[model samples]
Target: MEKKVQQYYKLKQKQKEIEKELAGLREEIIAYCSSQDSSDAELGSYKVKLVVQNRKEYDDAKLYETLSDPEVWRLLSRADPAKVASLVKLNVISDERIHHTYTLKTVTLLQVDKK
Candidate 1:
């Protein structure tokens, strides 16, 4: 048991070191790609590319108000767990009402800490 725990800790430390080195290398690659005025570069068997992504944020209240159909909003929206839990605690909703609606699964996670 102790051997497994020690191995887990060692692997986590190695992962952190690898991630740090990758971030530094990624910066250099991006700089090179930008300086060349090209999105892609080829190095022997390996190729690297710089990608740009755009994400959109919407005003929920205005969006819903502007929508012609209420069903469209229902189809797009999902329940928030924190809000539901708060409502249950406040006696606004019953646990039995929502209990059978969702499946419950158990997940196991391993975490190692240095002291």
Candidate 2:
């Protein structure tokens, strides 16, 4: 068990070192591309995208208000009343209802521009 744990830690440390090296190389590639004549390039099989991504932070007020809508609540209420009962069990059901939240979004793309 101890040997396995040691090996796992060693692998994790190696992963961090490799990630750092990759990040530095990625920055170098992007800088070279940006200084070049075009924003698009194809290496062998990879393409790099240098762009700002869109981000959104929603207001929970809209979330709860949307839940108050009868139609939306109907779809959810069909699941089980026991879950509804559990909310009632907590007593915060009045202000805090049962719902889910969107946490994160991600996309990966590769582009290589020639300098």
Candidate 3:
């Protein structure tokens, strides 16, 4: 009877540990999903452009194509929002001279939750 009691206590302890681990994993998953969702929203419609003087004799301009939603989400999931915003600002500054560069601005469309 004593042996059985000890076994039961051990099992309960193990169960508690497992439950704690599961809870931690659940939180991590939730965080990951939230980040992915944010990224998906950001990448849905984004663009950037560059304007620079080439050879100091001619003005050269370049446009960086926006990534697809999936790609943008994948990237945003791993990127910091502040960093992304900073890059966008930098691009805007660099391309300020070019009128078309305004079109290259990044626009984050908010996702509406459907009930």
Candidate 4:
């Protein structure tokens, strides 16, 4: 009986941990969705529309295939700054505002050009 009670408590604790992790993940998704790039406002509340102009799914292998090209970074560096700004304005890239210290490194590797 005591062993069964301990097992039951352990199961409950594990369930609570899973729930907490799931909630954290949901918050992360929300943060990513309503990120600074996606919507911006100061002080009071404001409405912003988010539209996914293009959507496609890539599995782990396909994702690796898309990301493993070394030439991509070189091409990005060679792209026009103005065009990169326009692309950012068009929401072509993820809109997470990185810190200034990591700015050059992060932006150069990815197609995220700050406007």
Candidate 5:
């Protein structure tokens, strides 16, 4: 058990070092691609392609103020888990009702830390 723990710790340390080096290389590659103004490049047997992704975010309060229909806001909004949990704790919502409404899951993880 001790030997396995030691091996796992050593592997995790090596992984962190490798990830740090990879992060630096990734930045350099991105810089090179931007400087050349090309999305695709080839080096020896490796081919690199730059991918651009865009995301849209809206302000909920502003959206609500702009919208005429309350139903539209209701359609866009979903139940918040934290608020539901608070209701359950306050006894406003019964445990049986919560159990029927949502599926509960528990996750277990093992973490090794250097002392």
Candidate 6:
């Protein structure tokens, strides 16, 4: 267990170092793309495409107070049929837009010794 814990910490440190390097490279790539006015570029045989995504989020409190109604619910219901599945499970009354797909999960290392 001790050995696995040590290995996990060591690997995590290395992962952070790689993540920093990756962030730096991403910035450089974006810089190059902006300078060349290109959304995509060829790197040897691989194509590097820069994608930018945007979303609109509203305050849950405001949504609960003024926005959420039978009309807005009907609109979202038609636009996203599957969304209602998860929202139905939630106990909240706010029908405000949220980032349901963008979820962060912690990856913990657990080791069990054979009895």
Which lDDT values do the candidates have, in the order given? 0.58, 0.57, 0.44, 0.44, 0.59, 0.55
lDDT of 1 by residue, 4-28 (tens): 9999999999999999997777777
Worst lDDT run of 10 residues, candidate 5, spans: 106-115
Compared with the true structure, what per-residue lDDT tens digits does model 2 show for residues 47-70? 666654432333445544646867
Top candidate on lDDT is 5
* TM-score, cand. 2 vs. native: 0.45
lDDT, model 3:
0.44
lDDT of 6 by residue, 56-111 (tens): 34334443445358765654543242454345346333333443423334332212
- What does each candidate score in C-alpha RMSD? 15.4, 10.7, 19.0, 15.5, 15.4, 12.5
List model 4 lDDT by residue over 13-106, tens digit each: 9999999997776566446546666533332353333333332222334323443455533444433444444445776533342111122321
Residue 29, candidate 1: how far off, in angstroms? 0.2
Point to the candidate with the largest TM-score: 6
User: Lowest summed-lDDT stretch of 10 residues in model 1?
Assistant: 106-115
Task: Give Cα distance to truth, residue 49, candidate 4, Å.
Answer: 15
lDDT (10s digit) by residue, model 3, range 1-115: 9999999999999999999997776556445546665333322343222222222111122222332345443544433434444445766323233333223333332232332
Clashes in model 6: which pairs? none
- Candidate 4 segments exceeding 4 Å error: 36-115
